[model samples]
Target: MPISRFPFFSSKRRSSEAFSLLRRFGPSKRIQSCNYGKSSRNGNGKPESNPLVNVDIQAPRSWGTYVIPGALLGFVGLAAIFHYNDERRAIPKGQGNKSSGNFVKGPIIGGPFTLIDTENQTITERNLRGKWVLLYFGYTSSPDVGPEQVQVMAKAIDKLEAKHTIKVLPVFVTIDPQRDTPSQLRAYLKEFDPRITGLTGPVSAVRQMAQEHRIYFKKVEEEGDDYLVESSHNMYLLNPNMEIVRCFGVEYNEDELADAVLKELKRTQN
Candidate 1:
């Protein structure tokens, strides 16, 4: 048939035909085998020369660069809010304190108190209604601060009475009641304005009254005959309802006190 059925072909002729086939296709088969071996050794069955296999890796970015500035900004915002609130609390309630004409609600001050006046007449908080009251706490033995404060009150009262029909009762309460009896207070008050009223009572009653009005007072012991009353210099302006309208510090002078009283009167009228 073709090549006489092959079983009868000579051995030398078979060898020669196999050699010719190898020369034509042996290189392609050997290359495929080598590629398969390389893929198995790399573990993913991918070629070593693949571009995706040797990709360059980069490090992850840190969060501190963004986080620190955000925290600082938050802290600054909180401080600004607190400062705004503190400034608002410092604003006064009536006119003459500022020209803006804005009224801020002040703190609620003053409380109930009962004591005896210069005439030995019992005076309670209720008796002081329907009239504005200027209240101060001091002793007759005060060296310098007490007299100056009383003068300020007297001048303010004279100015108010001369200008307006308002009735203001300037009341002085003694912190040292041990030596300030009714007669003693009357004589001490005579040195100041005639419109001023002096009040004194038992030690317990005076202490209670001072506590109610937030007046700080303490007895200072001296080695010799010298004695002093350590206390805060405070003056309170009370409305007709016996409620504290404003508190004047030691910094205010006679003119400033008068101006503040006038502004308060005008504010009440409005």
Candidate 2:
């Protein structure tokens, strides 16, 4: 064939070349991109090393996954803190109230009964109504435990009345009722406080009262065919309603006893 006059490509040939280049590197072709020289996954499920092209990648965000659980945990923690505070606030500030139910409130078997006091005045359950009573049960021959407890009661009563302007009737009931006649009890009580009252009755009656209170006692035999009674030394604090409010040791400190009695008084008043 003879040589053509024009050496440059024809328009159709130029258009074909342009089309081929676009097919190799056009917007429709898959592009790979990465950041900071770290490879990222591309849409083709392959690691990409290029940095200039746009890529679809995701990072963990806190809002959608963690926000709700964190909020719930915070709410639970705050509720527990508030509940503990409320329980601490509910503790008794003074003498506490008796538990409601099968528990006895006063001397278990106390009822209308006559007993000679320190001054030989007749006292009965009815006479004690509407007055706070501190009842002590023990024998005159009791070791230091009994007598010392009575002294504590006297002092505690005095302290409470002095500070809080409250009066408490302290009564000593004999556990060895058979041997502790009215006269013997009266004489023994004088060693404590003149305000301390003494009570004596038949053994059966005394046992009734002790049983009602669930107090334990027994008569131990001695050499003289006589017996010494070992019994509970509980000092019971009673409300004006004749209900047992607190049972404390005879040796309770004045502050502790006074606080307990005062708390009960507040409860009854309410």
| TM match of model 2 to true structure | 0.57
Q: Compared with the true structure, what per-residue lDDT tens digits does model 1 show for residues 140-204?
A: 88899988889899888888888775678999999998888889888888888878989888898
| Candidate achieving the largest TM-score | 1
* Cα distance off (Å), candidate 2, residue 76: 45
Off by over 4 Å in 2: 1-112
User: Which residue pairs come into collision in candidate 2?
Assistant: 94-263, 95-260, 95-263, 95-264, 105-244, 106-244, 108-212
- The model with the greatest lDDT is 1
Return the TM-score for candidate 1, rounded to 2 decimals.
0.61
lDDT of 2 by residue, 9-60 (tens): 3534554565456546555535443332213447764556454554333443
**Candidate 2 accuracy as lDDT:** 0.70
